[model samples]
Each structure stands twice: as structure tokens, then as C-alpha cells.
Target: MAKSVAPGRPNQFLRNLNSKIACIPMMLTALVIFLGGTVWTVIYSFTNSKLLPRATFVGFDQYERLWAASRWIISIQNLAIYGVLCLIFSLLIGFVLAALMDQKIRFENTFRTIFLYPFALSFIVTGLVWQWVLNPEYGVQGVVRSLGWESFTFDPLYTPEIVIYGILIAGLWQGTGLVMCLMLAGLRGIDEDIWKAARVDGIPMWKTYIFIVIPMMRPVFITTLVLIASGIVKLYDLVVAQTSGGPGNASEVPAKYVYDYMFQAQNLGQGFAASTMMLLTVAIIVVPWAYLEFGGRKRV
Candidate 1:
């Protein structure tokens, strides 16, 4: 006995019915938790909530104060420097490592393990390790001085102007391995036939990679870019562990700023305002990419 379907109802809704049913809980969680929380945060950003949330709206005062604060300004500057360098170096170094690994070199597994081992460590561990490594008395500076290079100086943690760059070093070491693995996966997916064709055509290996293989890895690059960008935006733990935003707030970032305000300073509205701005920043990056990536495909 067949159960009759409703007239004019498409069967598409019933397709993968179990999968759809399974996804309902996830969808509802996203709607209720993420979307709802985002809306609540945005709403509170406009109010004068302090210690406790109050609905008393104060317009853009919180935002104005946030922008005007020197600490916030410095945090933004540090983030900008860290974000840009981290993106460029991570991609470049990762791709280079992936390319080297793709050469069928001897002991490839050993090399891959060595490169990727750091990523297994948490950021806190990475930060702490790097902090010691960069310590003036017993780190690189000390070791070099011990080797009789008495004038050599390489400490970055205590230096205010270069403190952010110190953080960048830890970030790169921990992150580059993951990026390399991702790029290697993309490289491995490339067809052997393409390489054969390029070789037969007398193309240089580098030129082939530059002109053909990289373009084919657009999806991988985009995914890597998004991952790195998100990490940069929400960066806090590394800074906290490495410098505690010290050397007088030189390594302070937006996430740290928000946390310090919301909890430490007991200023909910200011924290929410900063968080809203962070959301806006993410939206600005994501919306256009989403449109170009998906919308353009639909149009085609």
C-alpha cells in the first residue's frame, strides 16, 4: 500500500529525508544560539550596560569611546600588522614547504612529521615555548652570547616596538605547518597527466606550477585564507600567554580588548561595541567573497 503524496508538493523536500531530519537539530542550534546571540550582542552594543545588562540605550556612545581609547587604537594597529604579515608569510612559506615535500624526497614522512609536529601543540604551549626561546637571559640571545657573540640581541618579548613581531614569530611557527599540510593535500590532488603534459611541452617546473597548478588550487587557497583570517581576528590566547598584552599593551588585540572590558572592566556595552565592530569586520570580508564564490556560480 503506497501512501499518496499531496498534490502540487514537490518530492525534493522528501529527498534525503533522514539526512535532513538529522540536520534539523544542528540548524535549530545555529539559529537559536549563534544567530540569536549575535542579535542580542548587537542590540546591547547600543545600550549603556555595565556590570549588568540594561536596556537603556545610549546610542553610539560606547563605540565613540572605544574608538577614542588609545588602548583600543593600539590593539587595532597591532592586529593589522600581525594579520597582514601572518597571511603573507604563512601562505608563502606553507606553499614552499608543500612544494619541497612534493618532490618525492627521501625520508618524506620524517620531514613531514618534523614540520607538522608544532601544530599539535596548543597556542598556549607554543606561546610559552616561544616566550622562553625569546627570553633575553637564557633564550636565543643568551645562547648566541654564550657562543661569544656578546653584542647579539634577539629578544622581542620585552621590546615594545617589536613585541608584536615577536608574537608573529610564534604564530608563524605554529600555523605554517598546518598550512603546509593543507597545501600539500591540494598539490597531491593534482593530476599526474598534467605534469606529464607540461614536461612534454618543455615547460619549466616553476612556470608550470605558477601558471597552472596554483590556479587549479583556488579552492584550497580560499579555504586557507578564511582559516587564517578567522584565527587572526580572534587572536588572544597566544598574546596572553606570550606577553599578556604587556610591554604596555603593545600586543593587545581586539579579542583581548573585548574580554578585558566585558569581564575585567565590567563594561558590557563597550565590550559589545568592540565585538560588533569585529563582527562587522568579518562580515565585510566574508559577504563579498561569498557572493563572488557562490553567487557568481549561480549566475553562470
Candidate 2:
């Protein structure tokens, strides 16, 4: 027999009874629709579903075919190349632009708007506009040729080797502005006391930025990283509107591969497998890094 035990802390969940009851529908939708749909996609990925999702459990048969496909291989390679370069260049350009903008320059508002204007356009619009500009017929290559350079050959969309870089250029143009804005906000949030302390110590300005300012703005950097990573993973519309995996599938990305398999190829199993692999990629590759970077209670 046990003595009478004291009750534990009151359930905060019970305190919000009215709100919780109101949120039941939302909770049900989240559980049954979103979570259920995700579970369905993952479970069915193991089956050899075709035009319609057939419940023929094939135990990794779809995954085996997905890995063996040349298109998937090319897509992965392209994603790797595109992800790495995009991260480096976008961060570099954004930070540099943000630093320059922080100099308290005149007409700062005008300059910032000019820089960020491209970000206002959707990826589809951006891709189409760039497609025409990059085209050799009426684009830069043709325009340059008209200026007495008959051998001008700047056709990136058609060049299999460098087509990925071509897409990278457009991506950077449209994306770096947001990064710059984020970095600028971070930089501004740096306390004046820090700068004064650095000045009193006769620290070099660049060294102050590197050693003090950057470390202090860890949250901003993390936010920008998430944004850029999301853009990299969802990189379909731009590729579709711009290159369409042309020049022999040189710039085919994973999203496009998944879409093609699901919709065009009519292989739901293969598409589901590819998509599930994407989720795994984000989980295995990105999730850990993010957790390590920003997950802990410790602040920079």
C-alpha cells in the first residue's frame, strides 16, 4: 500500500481547453491529411505502383530502378554541383553587398531597391526572361555577334558541360538580394558598444567584422542558410522554364526527375521512391547539420 501522493503540476494543455477544442479540426487535418499522406507516400514507395498506386509490395524494387536510371544519376550530380556553388557564391556576394550597404552610403534606399528588384519576380517569370536573354538567336550571344564579333559563342543553355552554371547565374541573381537583406539586418543589429570596444582596442575593421560581428549574427546566417537550401531543393520551376533539361539533360535536377517519373512516365512507385529519397536526403544530409548548427539552447 502506498501513502497518498501529491498531484503533479496541473496540465497546461488542460488550461487551454476552449482553444484546444477549437483546434480539434486543425489537429485532425494535420494528423489525418498531412501525416497520413506522408506515411502513405513512404509506405507505397516500396511497392511497384504504376499509373495508379497499386499495392504490390516489391521490397525496394522501385528504389533499385531509380538508382540505376541515368537520369537520376545525372540529376544527383547536377544537384551536388549546383548546391555547393550556389551556397558559396550567394553567401559571398550577399555578405559583400550587405557590408557595402552598411557603410551608411547616400541613396541607400534606391540602391537597395535596385538590388532587390529581381527578387520580386517569380521563378517562372525570371526563368522565362533569362531564357530569352541567354538564347543565342536574340539574346546576348546574338547581340554581341551583331557588334562585329562573328565568333561570339556564349550559349550556356545549349552547352551540356556549363548549362548548370548558366542556371546558377540566374538563381544567384534572383536569390542573393534576400541574402543581402538578411545579412544587412544582422549587421545592423550589432551593438554600437561592440564597435566602440573594437575601436578602443585599435582592432582592424575587417577583423572586427570577422571575429565579433559574424559570430553575433548566427541566427541570421542560419535563417539565410535555410532559405537557400529550400531554394536549392525546390529547384524545378526555374529549370523547367529555362532549360527544360535540354542540351541532353545536362541541368536536370532531382525535383524535375521526381516530377517526370510521377506525372510524365506514369510510374508512381518510382516517383514516390525518388521523392522519399529526397526526404531522406534532407533528413540525413541537411537535418543533422542544421541540428548541430542551430538546434541547441546555446546561443552564439
Worst lDDT run of 10 residues, candidate 1, spans 1-10
Write one digit per residue (lDDT tens) for candidate 2, span 115-161: 89999999989899989999999999999999999998998999999
Root-mean-square deviation (CA) per prediction: 2.9, 2.8
TM-score of each: 0.96, 0.92
C-alpha lDDT of all candidate models, in order: 0.95, 0.92
Q: Which residue segments of model 2 deviate by more than 4 Å?
A: 1-8, 18-29, 293-295, 298-300
Q: What are the per-residue Cα lDDT tens digits for candidate 1 across 174-285?
A: 9999999999999999999999999999999999999999999999999999889988998999999999999998889999999999999999999999999999988998
TM-score of 1: 0.96
The count of residue-pair clashes in candidate 1 stands at 0
- Screening candidate 1 with a backbone cut-off below 3 angstroms (N, C-alpha, C), the clashing residue pairs are none
Clashes in candidate 2: how many?
0
Among all candidates shown, the one with the greatest lDDT: 1
